[model samples]
Target: MNIAIVGLGVIGGSFAKGLQAAGYTNVYGIDVSESTLKIAVDQGMIKKGFIEANDILQDMDVIMISLYPNQIAPFVEQHKNRLKDGAVLTDVTGVKTTIIEKVSNILPSTVDFVFAHPMRGSEKQGIIGADHKRFIGANALITPIATNKEASLQLIEKLYKEIGFDQVTRVSPEKHDEQIAYVSQLMHVLSVAVVNSQQASEETLTYAGNSFQELTRIADINAELWSELFLNNRTGLLKSIEHFEIELDALKHTLEENDDERLKAIFRQATNKRREWY
Candidate 1:
């Protein structure tokens, strides 16, 4: 199991450490950030480290791309041909259709790219955030493109299970991206918008309520990384935001009209939905 992780950030580091803890060896960390590589090596998260993409794939049996969405196309283009024959290359990237489609279009048939998304993360970053505890019982969605489903879906699911993921669900790229656009991408947008709308002064934060505090916690996100995701999945995210706006407007209408009956009905609906939700 010669595994190569390109980002060496939170997800990559977590997966590397998880594999190691599962008794696997020969894991390699690859990242452009020299500091990140040093941190992983010092922590023994990966057996060794490499700075270049080429160096990392030389002996890699499986490669996981943990870079941002915008970086996926170019990264795949450069490494598609270099992959060892019969090697399985998957990614921890959130969006699937865009990445899987472009990569499959460019890569050779010998290379199997099993697209997957682990719906787990923390507000932290870098190798320090490498422990795979968050993934112990998290659901991992293994998204395989139509052309690649029969080719590598089973292998990807097996790997996720071996990594201690709680459950493995499969879906097409189109469906995966559509759902993520709401659950993952939309939440980030809402968090950003909520925090920005406040534009709170230092004093205001000092007086913030628990509810306000909890809602805006994710606002302390990596702007560069999140901004890329919002833009990459702009079409889907915009649609999610639009749906949210419509609902919010309806609530505002109820409040402005002081329609007690309508408000109660709305609250009842929300309560029922929340209670019924999984």
Candidate 2:
């Protein structure tokens, strides 16, 4: 299928790489940065694609908008008419409810846009870090609007399956964001908090423990992009952070009292909860 991916950063670039790895040809891309486009072409993720949106919509089979949350609404509004009738549209944005609602408001009846979120990402940004293998077995969430055809939806599912993500499932856009708040967004927030709280000198930081080091792994995130996500889904994210803080505060009180039995019980509960993944 001929695919046109907008916002050629991590998720967009990875989609191109995965499409190629799955033996799909005629993959196209659109991004504002010339340098990133060059990196994508040089890496052979795209065969040939134009940076101009209007110039490249003629033969676009399926469109994937992997942009930051705020862009989803206006971007789709502008391009809804340009996309060919019956062409399926989808996205890889982190939060889906607002985006899906924005899409629903502006989308023409002719073109169908489905909302999907692949549960895979990395700290790195841009085409430089694009890897097809990253989401090989990861969960890919598909949430189609009421207007979308069953066959068209299946086509998107088939494409993901071909790229080795058959563990696909359905989700309502609202629930997708609520679940992701704890699983993905809150993790970034915690990492940022850890990095912000630390005031160690460079030499002093060199002796950090394993857990301390791990806590800050995602702290130095790309602020510009992450800022967009955090604000767009601010409500859900704030609730997740608040609940996490409450849990942490309870543990702090346990430690202050040297409550051995309570600490052991808390650790045991965490272990039991974590063991389910094993």
Candidate 3:
């Protein structure tokens, strides 16, 4: 298959490497940065690299757009006609509802857009940080509409599995966004909050332990990308935040009232829940 990856940043670059590792020889890359394209080709991650979408779009069997949430629809709209007929188009966008809806409306009937999210990433950004091994044992979620072809969905599932995903589960776009808001987005929010809550000096981090380091690791986030994700999924994110606030307030009340039993109950409940889930 002639697979092409658009926007060769961390996610796109990683996907290219993963595909190459899976023995895909016809992989191509597209990016705005000439330097990034050069690096991908030099590293043997892609067979060729293009600075922009050109005639190469016509030959691609599968195209993965790994871009920011807001740029997804616009990229499709701008290049819809350039995409090959019957080609499978997919994206790595975190939020799905708005993107799937908009892209579905604008996308050609001949092209299949199967929205997917690979549940793995790093604090680092761009091609320099790309790592094919990140997909190993990771989970992937596919949000397919009623109009998507069964063959296309199967192709994506098989591709992800070949590239090292442990599981590929099908889900509704609404459910995907809702669950992601809690698990992914909420986690990032808490990490950022934990880091920001402290006014750190050089000595402050020296005093930190493994737990603190682990909690604040993702706090070294790509601010612009995360800000867009947070706002794009704000409705679901806000709901999660509100729910967390209620739980936090209850903990605070327990502390203020000197309810030792209640505090112990809360701790026991959390421990049990964690044990059950993990």
Candidate 4:
């Protein structure tokens, strides 16, 4: 398949590498950065790279947009007509509702835009940090709108599997946002808060442990990207934050009251609940 990936950042760059590794030649990349384009070409991640949308997209079988949620709509709107007929387009943004709706509403009947979220990435930023290994055990969620045809969606599912994702599941845009709010967005908030809550002294730094490092690993995240994601899924993300706050308040009250049994019970429940993922 002739593929064009718009936005050659970490996710986009990684996707180009993954597609190339899967034996998909003719993979072209689009990015605003000239350096990124050159690097992508040099790394054999793409056959050609363009600084902007152009005629090369006219023959593309699939156009995978790996951009920020805010950029997804405008980019699709600007290039909708440039896409070839029967092209299967997809995205890898963290949040999906607004982007999917906006793009779906504007897309032509000749082309289909399928929304997907690959649950994989790193806290590191830019093309230099792109790593296809990130998707090794990740889940790829396909959030299809009514406009997406069965054949196109099925082809996308096959592509996800071909790209080495462990699982491929279909979900509505709404459900995808709600679930991601809890599983992904909330965790980033917790990590950021945990890192900020610390008041380290020179001596106290020596007492840091594995748990602290693990929990704060994602604290050094891309603030601009995360801020857009948080606002895009505001309602679901707010609800998740409220739920977390309530749990935290309960724990704080229990600790203040010196309720050892309650704390122990809470720990037991958390341990048991977490084991469910295994």
> Highest TM-score, which number?
3
* Model 2 residue pairs with clashes: none
TM-score of each: 0.93, 0.93, 0.97, 0.96
- Give the per-residue Cα lDDT of candidate 2 at 166: 56
Count of backbone clashes, every candidate in sequence: 0, 0, 0, 0
* Worst-scoring 10-residue span by lDDT in model 1: 144-153
lDDT of 1 by residue, 34-99 (tens): 999998888878898889889768678888888888787788788776888888888887887777
Query: Candidate 3 on 1-278: residue-level lDDT in tens?
Result: 99999999999999999999999999999899999999999999999999878758989999999999999899889988888899999998899998887888898988999999999977889999999899999999999998899999999999899999999999999999999999999999999998877576667778899999998899999999999989889999999999999999999999999999999999999999999999
Task: RMSD for all candidates, in order, please.
Answer: 1.7, 1.7, 1.1, 1.3
Evaluated against the true structure, the overall lDDT of model 3 is: 0.92
The lDDT leader among the candidates is: 3
Error of 4 at 80 (Å): 1.3
Candidate 3 colliding pairs? none
lDDT of 4 at 186: 93
lDDT of each residue in 1-278, candidate 4, tens digit only: 79999999999999999888999999999999999999999999999999868758888999999888889888878888788999999999889887877777778899988888898878878899998888877899998888789999998888778888999999988999999999999999998987777575566458888988888788999988999999999999999999999999989989899999999999999999999977
**55-148: candidate 2 lDDT, tens digit per residue:** 8875787999988878888987887768887788888878877777777888888888878888887788888888878888888888767888
Candidate 4, position 156, lDDT: 84
